[model samples]
Target: MRAALAATGRVVRAETFRLLRKRRMYVLAALWWVVLPVLVLLLARVLQVTLTGSFVEGEAVSVKTLLQGLASPFGVARVGLVAPAYLSPSPYVIAVALLAAAGLGEPRTHRMWKSTLVAEPDRRAVLAGTFLTMQAFLGVLLAGAFVFGAAFGAIGTTFLPTAAEGAWGRLAGLYLLQWAHLATLLAFASLAIFVLRNVTLGVVTTFFLPPLVEGLYAVWRATAGFEPLNRFNALFQGLELQATLEAVPRWFLSNNLYLPARTSAAPLLDEVVGTLQAVGEEAGGGPGGAQIASLLGADLTLPHAGLVMAVYGAIFVTLLVVAFLRREVA
Candidate 1:
């Protein structure tokens, strides 16, 4: 057992080295983690400013205030849209998938798997290594993106941003749920790559085609009046994370901040009330809904969302390991 763990560790280090050896990995990392996040925050801020005319609604609002409002549903300054776009599952997942396809797929295509197996010998270790490296790569990107996005969110405000409690835990759940979502799909994509030996085909089957086909099928299903919508909904599963992320943080902020409405000194501004009430209604929110918003993300509970997606991932990943062990390197 200890030996297997040690072997897995070594393989993980080796896989990490292989990924870092590719120059494009760094480029993609910067683009997705840094560039894309910053761009999204700036663009969201600009949209808010163009319409509302402030970095935050009040120039005097603290930097902490902006960070609080971020990832929350309040559109007072339109800061909350970043989380969904950051985790859009398509563009972002495709970026990571393209890397996985190009990096891992090409090695198989070139028949390098033969030499790799000869060197490592234990197929499970190699698989574990690749999986860990991908998640580690993604972890760095997720953490860096959140930090950069939060910092960027505070750019035009006055004081430093205050990060909050168990709130961080909720956001962590959001990102981890994203990790599971992407991890599941990427695992599926890797299986497809191994089976077909074509990165384009593999990724499209797992990532690209599912969403498109699902959308069309959903329309057809609606037209045909299908009863249950739960079947095969994994491909389109990030909204629960987005809604939960937005909902919980807003709860935290409302508790901590001194919005005039909270004090009954003033009613909610027309825009703020409209946006919150509209989105909250769908999330099962209403008067006093903000306090209980943490109960569910959008329409689904986290457990339901997690189970629905994780079950498929568990099956695909098990098959992936088995297939790798049986695969012919030559």
Candidate 2:
């Protein structure tokens, strides 16, 4: 037992070092830091111009308002994080697929499995170490995104909202839920790699299959009236959370779990829109209103989304581990 644990630790360490040494790690970092912030900045500017008709040089109120819209916990969780995390072909999903393929499938492609098996001996420990390394890498990526968002908020607003009152608890909950969602993505990608046993095939399938399946499922559900099929899709399950009806089944994977903050922010958004409309009316612009419902849709009180995502993640992990154990390295 002791030897197995020691071997697992060594494999984990080696895998971590290997991942960090990859050129793609630098590319991922650059996207998170440089590209994401610049995109946010451009989005803010566009919103400012649309809302207020002109960008005031000294006054950053428009920018701040736009930032508030984009940075709201609700918008960030649903549209920003959840959408990209679950939606197939997204940069986040593709990056995770690539990382998982490189981590687990590369050994097979490069014929390193025999030597690795020789070094570790125990296949379970080797698989466990790879899983741990992938989890660690994903955790770091999510943490880096959080830090970049904080920096972006600071740059856009004079006073970033502090964790006063119950804000800290809410923020913490949002982070945890988002982490859980991303972890599910990681497990799914790992499962694909283990099943395919080829790096390129695994990455391509993981990147493309979910969306294709989702599209087909959507058509079947609409045309065939098969609502139960919705549960099988992570993306569809997420969208169901936005349903306005009170009777929508409270699924464990709905986006509602992390978007309560968005509900609270709705009134503020309405007020901002009202203000913008008043200014526009005074300027002789045509009748216009900020469609809050269109922006955020209806808020549901389902708490089961987190639980569903957790269950799916466990299932994916279990399957991946089983496949890895049975796989012949030689």
Candidate 3:
């Protein structure tokens, strides 16, 4: 047991070092940490100027207002541990896909797996180590993004709203959900790259396939009047579940950040409310009806979506491991 633990630790350390050596990783970190935040702040500034024309030559803008303006761009909504803007699954998906494609695919492309196998021998351990390293790196990136958002909010705003009652508990759940969502995508990408032995193809498929499938499913639903297809979409599953769980609060916070303030009275909000009402009315009507109902709100039944994501992640990881173990690494 001691030896096994030691081996795993060594592999994890080695893999972490190897990934850090890659210039692309540095570039990605820079982009995410520095460039992205600056761009978001600039965009927020421009929007504020255009919308309110508040950037008078000598008028002083409160740091609080500036921070509030920054909130939308940085995905910080409300003063809670939950950042509604950062709740979307896209960033996590994109980051994991890119990392998996480059990290896993490059080994095959450069014929490095053989040497890696020879050094590690225990392929499972190596895979586990690499997977752990990837997760850690992703966690760091996510944390960095969160910290940057918080920093912006702190510096530009004098007042931070207290998190809503029970938000702390919900925040913990949100963190786990976000991690699971990212892990599922990462596993899928890993399997794709491992099986195809092409990073570009894996990346392309990871980025494109979900949306394409969802689009087709949407078309099918429109024509067939069936919503079952929605259940299979990871993006929709995550977002809808989030929406359902948070309900009106989530929608209100998100809309305030993303949409123009003038749209508060728009039909969109009414439509959303109506949808939620319809879902509530249809709940427990039938399996299909329940699913449809869940689709309408923040889907507090997030465990179902989490389960689906887990199954996908498990299947992909299992397949990757089995394939790697059987393949002759020459």
Assess each prediction's global lDDT (C-alpha) against the native.
0.54, 0.61, 0.58
Please provide the root mean square deviation of candidate 1 (C-alpha atoms, Å).
10.5
| Candidates' RMSD to native | 10.5, 9.0, 9.7
Clashes of each: 1, 4, 6
Task: Mark the regions of model 1 whose C-alpha exceeds 4 Å error after superposition.
Answer: 44-89, 158-166, 226-298
Higher-scoring candidate on TM-score, 2 or 3? 2
Please provide the root mean square deviation of candidate 2 (C-alpha atoms, Å): 9.0
Write model 3 residue lDDT over 180-215, tens digit each, in one string. Answer: 556767887888778877788888787667656555
* Residue 59 of model 2, lDDT score: 59
Best model per TM-score: 2
Highest lDDT model number: 2
**Tens digits of lDDT, candidate 2, 5-109:** 998999999898888888887787677655666566566656656656455634556544455656443223223343344333465666677678778878888
Q: Estimate each model's TM-score.
A: 0.65, 0.68, 0.67
In angstroms, how far off is 235's CA in candidate 3? Answer: 30
Off by over 4 Å in 3: 47-89, 158-173, 225-300
Single out the weakest 10-residue window by summed lDDT for candidate 1: 252-261
**Which of the two candidates, 1 or 3, achieves a greater TM-score against the reference?**
3
